[model samples]
Target: MNPIIELRHISKTYYLGKLDVPVLHDVSLSIMPGEFVAIMGHSGSGKSTLLNILGLLDKPSGGEYLLAGKEVSRLSDDELAGLRNKFMGFVFQQFNLLPRMTARENVILPLVYADNKTNAPDELTLLERVGLKERVNHKPNELSGGQQQRVAIARALINNPLLILADEPTGNLDTKSTAEIIGILKELNNAGITIVMVTHEPDLTEAADRTITVKDGVIVSDVSSGKQRTLAAAGSDGSMAAGFLTHNLLKLQRVRDYFQQAMRSLISNKTRSFLSILGVLIGVTSLIAMMALGQGAQEEVKKNISSLGSNLLFIHPAAGHQGGVALEAGAVTQISLQDVDAIRERVPGVARVTPYASGRGQVVYNGKNWNTRIDGTSADFPVIRDARVTEGRFFTDAEATSRAKVAVIGKTVQRELFGDRDPVGEFIKIKRIDFQVIGVLPAKGSSGWRDEDDKIIIPVNTAMYRLLGKENVDTVDVQVTDYNAMDDVSDRINKLFAVM
Candidate 1:
C-alpha cells in the first residue's frame, strides 16, 4: 500500500534581516492511511514547522513532498488552497471559531470556501458526533473551553477531509477538557479518519496510533502501534482515496459566500458597521457632488462663449491718452455707421456687419415702469449675435433708414411691463418718447453679474438720432463668412480704419 503522506529530506530556513535561522534539517518521514500520529517536541524544536509543511501551510526550502501520490511543489498557489480546502482539515489550539458565528455556523464555515460541497457531511450530524448536539447554537464565547474544541473538531469533519491536522488542540484546555478532546480524537481515528496531532505533552501521545518525537529539528524516535491500518485495508471499498488526486478550481459561488459572510459580520457589530457605511456614503456623495459642480461650470462657460456669437469679431475704438495719462474708452476715435457699411461692402469674407450702441433708459408701459439697458443695432443683429426673436419681427432696413420709433423687447423687459400679456405692437415710452414694440427676444439667462435678457433693442439710426442722441456708435460687430478668411479680413479692416 502506498503511503498517504511522504516526505524525503525536508529542510526549512527563515531569513531575519540577513540572518538565516534554520528550523528543520534533513527530516524524512512517512504515514500510512488511517493512522492517528502524534508529533511531540519541546519549545523551538522545529516540530510545528514540520507539521506546517506536512499540512501544506508552509513550503520547505529543500527536498520534495508528495501527498496522495502527487508532487506538492508542482501545484500553483490557488490549486494548493483548493487542495487544502478539499482534503486537509485543521484544528488550531485557539479554536479559531469566528466569534460572531454560532457553533453550527462555524462548523459549516469550511463548506463556504469549498468549490464542490455536494459531498459535504451534514454539520448538525457532525456536531452531534462530537458531543456538541446541545451546544450547536452557542457561540464560541458562550461555550466552555472543551466545548469550543469540540466545535473545532466538528468543523474539521464538515468537508470529510482525507487528513486532519491538529496543532496543539488541547493546549489551552483544563485537565478534564484535555481528556475529553483526546478521547474524541481517538474515537475519530478509530472510525477511520486519519489525524496527525502536534502536542508537547507526553500523555497525549498515548491516544495516538503512532508517536514521533523530534529534538533540535531532527527526528529522535518514531514508534508505531502494530494495529495501524494501511491504505488498502482502511479504504477497502475505495472511498478513502476517491477524488483525492483531483484539483478543485475556484468558482463564482465563493463570491456570494464571501458577501454573505461579510454581511453577517456587519450585522454582528452594529455600531462599527454603521460608522463604516456612513463614512463610505459621505465620501461617495462628496465625490459625485464635486464632479457635478465641475461639469456644470464647464457647460456654463461654453454657453457664455457661444452666446457671444460664433465666428464674430468686435471692433472697438481704443482709449485716448494725453501726457501718458489714459483717458476713457472711445474718447479718441469713434466707430460710425459709415464704417460698418464700408466693412460690409469692401471687407472680403464679411458675412454681416452692424453698428452697436448701448445706453441706460427708463421704459414705461401702461402703469408699469423698469430701468434697463437699451441696445441699438440693424436687422442683421439676430443672425450675427445668434439672438432668436421668439415673437414678432426685428425692424427692417427701411425702418432704420427712416429712423422709425420701433423697438424689440427682451424677456425681462416683457415680464416687467407686459406680465404674460403680449407686448407686440404695443407702444412703450423710452425716456418719455413713445416707441412701438415690434418683437420679443428669447430668454438668455444671466451672464456674469448681469442678465442678458434685461434689455431692449432698437434701430441704430433711431438710437443715435432719436433716443440716446449720440453722434457715433459705441462698437461695430462683424461676422465672417468662413473661419479661415478672418485674418485677411481683419488686416484689410485694420488698413481701412488706419487710413480713416
Candidate 2:
C-alpha cells in the first residue's frame, strides 16, 4: 500500500521584484498511515513553509504532491479549500477560537463549511470526547489556555478528517498543559488517525512515532517508527463503497445555525459590533438624504420650467438703429395691444396672449412700507404664467378693460406687507397709486439667485396708460398648445409684425 502523503523533489521560490529568493530545494519525503510525526528545526529553517505546503495551505513552485493517491498541486482555489475542509483539520498554537461563541459552537464551525449532515455526531458529543463536556457552554474568554486548546482539538476532529496538522500545539501552554496536550495527541494517534506536528521542544517528540529534523530547508535526519514495511499483499476484488458525507453536497438546514452563530458573535464583541452597525446606519442615512436632495432639485427645475409654460415665446419690440448707433431693444419701437390681439386670434398654435409692462414701486400697508415689483399684465396672466391665487380671485376681463386698479400680490409680498393678516380686499400703494390687493400668487420659491414670488400683477391697460403714461406695451407673453408648432408660429408672427 502507498503512504498517505508523498512529496517528490519539492522546490519553492519567491519573487521579490527582479530577484528570486529560494526557500526549499529538491526535498522528497513520505508519511505512512497511523504515524505520529514531529518536525523540529531552528527559527529560520523553512519548517513552517514546509508544513504549509504539506497541509495544502500553499503550493510549491516546483514539485509533485500526492495525497491519498491523488495529486492536488494544480487544483483551483475553491477546490483546495474544499479539500482542506473535507480531509484535513488544522490546529494552531494560538487556539483560534471565535471569542463570542461557546466551546460547542466553535467545535461545529468546520461542519458548517463541510458536508453538514443531520445525522452527524452531535457537537456536544465531540466536546465530551475531548474532555470538555463541562465547558461546552463556556466561551474562550471564560476558559484557561489548556481548556482553549482542548476546544480547538475537539473542533479539529469534528469533521472526522483523515489527517490532523498541529502547528506548535503546545507552544503557549504551561508544562502541565503541554503534557496534557501531548497526551491527547498520543491518544488520537493510537486510534488509527494520522497526525503531523511541528514543535521546537525536543521533549515533546518522545510521544511521536517518528522525529524529522530539518536544517536550512532540507531534511537532515529522519527517525522512523520502527515498523517494518515488508509484508505479503492481501488481495481484494470488490470495489469500495462511495462516501455519502463528502465535500460535494451541502445541507441547507445549517444556514439558520450559522446565522445564529453570527448573531452570537456580534453580541459577544459588543464595541466592535456597535461600531460596524453604526457605520451602516450612517451610510444608509447619507444615501437617503442625497437621493432626496437630488430628487427635490430635479422637481424644482421641472416646476420652474413648467411655470413658464411649454414652448412659449416672449415677443418683444425689435431694436432700433439711429445715426449708426444701435439703441437697446424696446427703446424706439414698441408693441401695441393690436399685435397681441392678432397673435391670439390668428396664430395656429398660440394658446393665450397676455400683454405685459412692469416697473418698480413702493407699497404701504398698515403703516409698513416695502419696495417691490409691480407687474402690469392682462387677465390671461394666470393662464400664460401658471400663477395660482391661493387667497383671493384674479381680476376679470371687464375689470382689466376698465383699468380697475385691482392687484394680485406674490407670497413674499404678502408676508412682508401683510404680516399674516389677510390682505385681500385691502389697498396698497404702487408709486403712490392706491391699488387694491385682490389675490395672492402661489409660492414659487427661488430659482438660482432670483425670487419668483416677490412681485405684483395688475391689468395691462392700467400699467400702460394709467401707471407709466406709456401708450404702447413692452412685451407680449405668448403661450402655445403644441411645442412642435412653435417655430412655424414664431416665423409667421415676425413676418406679420414686420409688415405692420
Candidate 3:
C-alpha cells in the first residue's frame, strides 16, 4: 500500500523584509494510509508550517511532497484546489463555521466547491452522524463548544475525502468539550478515516496511532504503532472500482450546494444582506445617473456640431499653411459638383454627397432688411446637417433643379426681418432677386467665430444663376456610413483627388 503523505527533507522559509526566517529544515516524515497521526511541538516550532505543507495550503521551499504517490508541486493552483476539494478535508480549532449558517448548512458547504454536479451527500444526514441531528438548524453562536466541534467534524466528513487535517481540533474547548472532540476523532479513526492532528498535549497523542515530536523545525522523536492499523480500503480490483462509483454518485447529490448555502445565509441574515446590497445599488445607480447626464451633455454638443454638418469631409482645396499655421478647414474653395458625384459613386463609406456654395448677401422681408450668409446646397442638406425645419418644408430636389427662387431662412434672419411674424411663404429679396421663403430653420446660437443662425439656404442652381451668379460649386460635403473608417475614407478621397 502506498503512503498517504510522504515528505522528504521538506523546508520552508518566509521573508520578513530582507531577513530570511526558516521554518522547517531537513524535515523528513511519512504517514501510512488510514492511520491517526499527531504532530506535537511547542509554539514557534514550525508545526503549523508542516501542517500547511501537508494540507497543500503551503508549498515547501526545497523538498518533494508525494500525496498518494503524485508530486504536489507540479499541479497548477486550480488543479491543486480541485484535488484538495476532492480528496482532503480540514478541521480547525476555531470550528470556523459561518456565523449566519445553520449546523447542516455549514456541514454541507464544502460540496459547493467539490463540484458535485449531482446527488450530493445529505447535509442533515452528516449532522446526524456527528450527533447533531437535534441541533442541525442551530447557528454557530447558538451551539456549545463541543457541539460546534462536532459540526466541524461533520463538515470534514461531508466531502468523503481520503484524509483529514485537524489543526488543534480541541485547543479552544473546555475539558469536557476537548474530551468529546478527541473521542469523536477516535470514533472517526475507528471507522477508517485517516486523521492527522496538531497538538502539544500528551493526552491528545494517546489516541493517535503514531506520535511525532518536533523541536526547532526538526523532528526530535517519532513513535509509531508499527503496522498496527492499516487503512480500510477496497483492495480488491472490483471492490475499489465499486467504492469510487458510489462516491461519485454521492458527489452528484449536492449540485451547486455552495450557492444554496450562501443564499440561505443571506436569507438568514436579511438585515445585513439588505444593507450590503442597498449600498451596491446606490453606488451603481449614482454611476448610471451621472453617466446619463454626461451622455445628454455630449449629445447636445453633437447636435450643435451636426447643425454645422457633422460627419462631413469637405472636398474643397486644402489651404497651404501660411507662417507655419494651417488656415481654417474648408475656408477656400476649389472643389466642384463633379467631385461630389465621383465620391458618391466610388468611395466605400460615403453615405451621401452634397455640393454646396456659400457667399455673403443682404435680404429684405416686410420692409425689414438684414445682412446674412447665403448657402446653396443639395437636397441632402437638411439630412446631413441635422437641421430641422421649424415651419413649412425644405425645397425638394425637383425644385432645386428647376432653379426655383425658394429659400430656407434661419432663426436670426426671421428675428431680424420677420420679427415674430410668420416668415414661411413670405417673399424675401436676396441680392435684389425676389425669392419666396419656403421654410424657417431651428435656432443655432452664435459661436466665437460667427453667428450660425444668421443665414439662408437655397438651391445651388438658383443661388448661382439668380443670386450670387457663381457657376462652380466650392465645397463637397460627404457623409459616411461608419465613423471608425472616416479618416481612411478621407485619405482615399484625397488620393482620388491627387489622381484627378
Candidate 4:
C-alpha cells in the first residue's frame, strides 16, 4: 500500500538576525491513510515544526515532500490554499472560535473558503455527534472549555477532510476534559480519518496506533501497534480520484455566509462597527472627491474653450465693493444696446457681436407651470456661443430690432412643458406675456449643480423692454475675424469702453 504522506531528508533552520538556529536535521517519516499517530518530544525538540511541515503549513529548507503522490513545492499559493481547505483540517490548543460568532457559525466557517463543497458533511450532524446540538446558537463565552473544544472538533470535520492535525488540543483542559477529547479522537480514528497529534503527555499515546519520540531535533524511536492493518487488508482504496470528488457547489452560499457573519458582528458591537465604517467612508469619500475635482477641473476647462467659439471674447462688468465687502456683478456698471452697437461698428477685427441679459420667470403652457431661467440675446448669439438650433430657425435680426415677442427653448424646458409634442409655432406665457416658440436648442448636459438645458431664450430688445423691464443689458459677446488679432481687439474694446 502507498503511503498518504512522505518526507525524505527534511531540514529546517531559522535565521535570527546574524545567528543560525537549527531546529530539525535530516528528518524522514511516512504516515499511512488510517493511522492515529502521536509525536512526543521534550521542550526544545522539533516535533511541532515537523507536524507543521507534515500539515503543509510550513516549508522545509531542503526536502522533497509528497502529499497523496503529488509534489508540494510546485503548487502556487492559491492552489496550496485550495488544497489545504479541501484536504486537511487543523485544531489548535486555544480553541480558536470567533468570539462574536455562534457555535454553528464557527463550525461552518471552513466552507467559506472551500473549493469543493459538494461532498461536505452535514454541519448539524457533525455538531450533534460532538454533543453540541442544543447549544449550537450559543457563543464561545457561554460554553465551557470542553464544549468549545468539541465545537472545534466539529469544525475540523466539516469538509470531510482526509487528515486532521491537532497541536496540543487538550493542553488547557482539565483531567476530565482531556479524557473526553481523547475518547472523541479515538472514535474518529476508528471511523478511518487519519489524525496526527503533537503532545508532550505520555498517556495520550496509548490511544494512538503509532508513537514517534523525538529528542533534541532528532527522532529516537518509532513504535507501532501490532494489530495495525494496511489499506489492502482493510478493503479500502487509497487513490485520490476514488476518494474525493472535485465538483464545485454552494459558491454563492459562501458569500451569503460571509455577509451574514459580518452583519451579526456589526450588530453585536455597535460602537466599534460604527466608528470603523465611518472611518472607511470618510477615507473613500475624500479619495473620490479629490479625483472628481481634478478631473472636473480639466473637463470644465475643455468645455469652456470649446463653447467659446473660435477667436471669441466675452466682456462683462466688473464686480463692485461696498464697505470692504464684495458686491454683485454689474452692480456698478451695466452694458446697454448702444454700447453693443458702438463696439460692433468701431472695434477693429470684430466679426460678430451679440448683446446678452438674463433673468428667472414662471412659464405657463396648457395649465402646466414651471419656473425656469430666461436669456435675452441677438440673432448672432448662436454663432458666437456655438449653440445650434435643432428644430426651427432662430429669430432674425429684424425681430430683435422690432422687439418681437419670440422665444427658443432648450431640451430640458421642452421636456418639462411639452412631452414629445412639437413646441415650434406654439405660444407659451412668460411673466404673463405671450411669446411664440420659434426653435428648439440642442441638449447641453449639466454644469456643476446647474442644468444647462433648462432655460429659454428670447430677443434682447423684447426682454429689456417688454418682459424684464430693464434698460441696460448684462454683458456683450464679440467674435474676431482673425485668431491672432484677439489681444489687440480686446485692448481696443477696453479703451473704447473706458472713454464711453
On TM-score, the leading prediction is 1
Which scores better on TM-score, 2 or 3? 3
Model 1, residue 244: C-alpha shift (Å) = 7.2
* CA-RMSD of model 2: 7.6
Which pairs clash in model 3? 118-252, 118-253, 119-252, 119-253, 119-254, 120-252, 120-253, 120-254
TM match of model 3 to true structure? 0.64
User: Which ten contiguous residues of candidate 2 have the minimum total lDDT?
Assistant: 233-242
Output the number of the lDDT-best candidate.
Answer: 1
Cα lDDT tens digits for candidate 4, 70-107: 66745555556666777788888999999988999899
Per-residue CA lDDT of model 1 for 1-500, tens digit only, reads 66778898999999999999999999999887788999999999998999999888889999888786677855667667777888889999999999889999999998888877888989999999988889889999999999999999999988888789999999999999999999998888777778999999998998888899999999999998666454323443334334543544556798889899999999999999999999999999999999999999999998888777878878998899999999988899878888888889987889999888889999999889999999989988888888879999988999989999999999999999999998899999999999999999988899879999999999989999998989889988889988888888889999999888
By lDDT rank, best first, the candidates go 1, 4, 2, 3
Instruction: Please write out the lDDT profile of model 3 over residues 238-342, one tens digit for every residue.
Output: 233223323442343355464566687788789999999999999999999999999998988877776777667766666766788887654443566677778
- In model 3, what lDDT does residue 286 have? 100
Looking at candidate 3, the ten consecutive residues that score lowest on lDDT are 236-245
Error of 3 at 346 (Å): 26
**Candidate 4 regions off by >4 Å?**
229-253, 288-500
Candidate 1 regions exceeding 4 Å error are 1-67, 70-81, 99-101, 112-119, 122-125, 190-192, 196-355, 366-368, 378-380, 383-386, 396-405, 432-434, 460-466, 469-500
Shift of residue 37 alpha carbon in model 3, Å: 1.6
Kindly give the stretch of ten consecutive residues in candidate 4 with the minimal lDDT sum. 230-239
